[model samples]
Target: MDPKEIIARRVAKELSDGDLVNLGIGLPTLVANFIDPKIDVYLQSENGLIGLGPIPEKGQEDKNLTNAGGQYVTLKQGGMYFDSATSFGIIRGGHVNVTVLGALEVDSEGSLASWIIPKKLVPGMGGAMDLVVGAKKVIVATTHTNKGNPKIKTQCSLPLTAYKEVDLIVTELAVIEVKEDGLHLIERHPDTTIEEIINQTDAPLKYTNVKPMEVKS
Candidate 1:
């Protein structure tokens, strides 16, 4: 299976019915496609709306409505749009149940560093700082490695979005639970060994009692 698909599936499995979730661009956006149809979850976009649907069929684009990812989406029944200020109020007021954001780096204390690749790769820090801090649960979804190096570190080397806002991280190779004290390596990839996962990470990480994250049989 594709690694991105695995990450998406793993993320989708964590969702509870009736959650008002804000999904960031990129990998966070993919979670919508993987959510079980039987499980009804409300998707909120930072652009001032809630109850977002997945991408529409080709030739059915709705120019007036788009997601934070800039993709056209259908609004589910009862979906509503407000001003951007109100939308941010909902996010900043902590009414959001969960937020799934893509991260460039996450530290032992659950700090996230996502914007800017350095040397001006991107301009401006977006809604990340708010989403990570405002949501009741902040979950980061990203690959374990970036350009063959561990993205989870002892300390973030880049600018931070929020300190200790991340509750958990789902990577291609492991699922890490972040606590106030430190990160707990709660689950590794099905084939991954604890030693292997540790060696790949640049920081010291403690392990939890939970087993690995796997595709349910």
Candidate 2:
């Protein structure tokens, strides 16, 4: 499977039956496509929506409504729309159960840096910082590396969105849990070697409970 799909599928399994989840831009948004149809999770969009449904088929999309990333989406029955202020209030008030966000870098301490590169100009941080601190649980979905450079580092070089706020990290190669003790390696891609994961990650990893990644056929 493609790396982004691998990460998304893995994260999809982490959601509970009734969880309210917010998907950030990029790879994080892909998790919605992988959620099991039987599950009853509610997808929240920071752009002012709750109960977001799957992407509409072509010609069925509502251009007037979009997610925080501006991607067109369908709304599930009973879904509600409101102002952005209300959406953020739900986030800031700790109503969101989990949030999956794309990260440029996540350090050993679970610090996230995904807003900007500084060297290159990008859009300002919209609601990412708010989501990071507001969500009851945070999961970072990202590739292990970018252009062959390690994104899981000992320390983040970019500006941080939140300090040690991430709870879990799902990458193409490994599923890591950020603990008070250290970065714990919980699972790895079946086709990837432990040595390969270690070499590609700049941060030291604890493998006390490591296992092969579980992928449903």
Q: Output the number of the TM-score-best candidate.
A: 2
lDDT by residue (10-52, candidate 1, tens digit) is 9888889889999899888888888878877999999988989
- Which pairs of residues collide in model 1? none
| Top candidate (lDDT) | 2
Q: Which regions of candidate 2 are displaced past 4 Å?
A: none
* Model 2 pairs whose backbones collide: none
Q: How close to the true structure is residue 216 of candidate 1, measured as C-alpha lDDT?
A: 49
lDDT of 2 by residue, 63-89 (tens): 887888888988989899999899999
Estimate the TM-score for candidate 1: 0.95
Runs off by more than 4 Å, candidate 1: none
lDDT of candidate 2 at residue 51, scale 0 to 100? 85
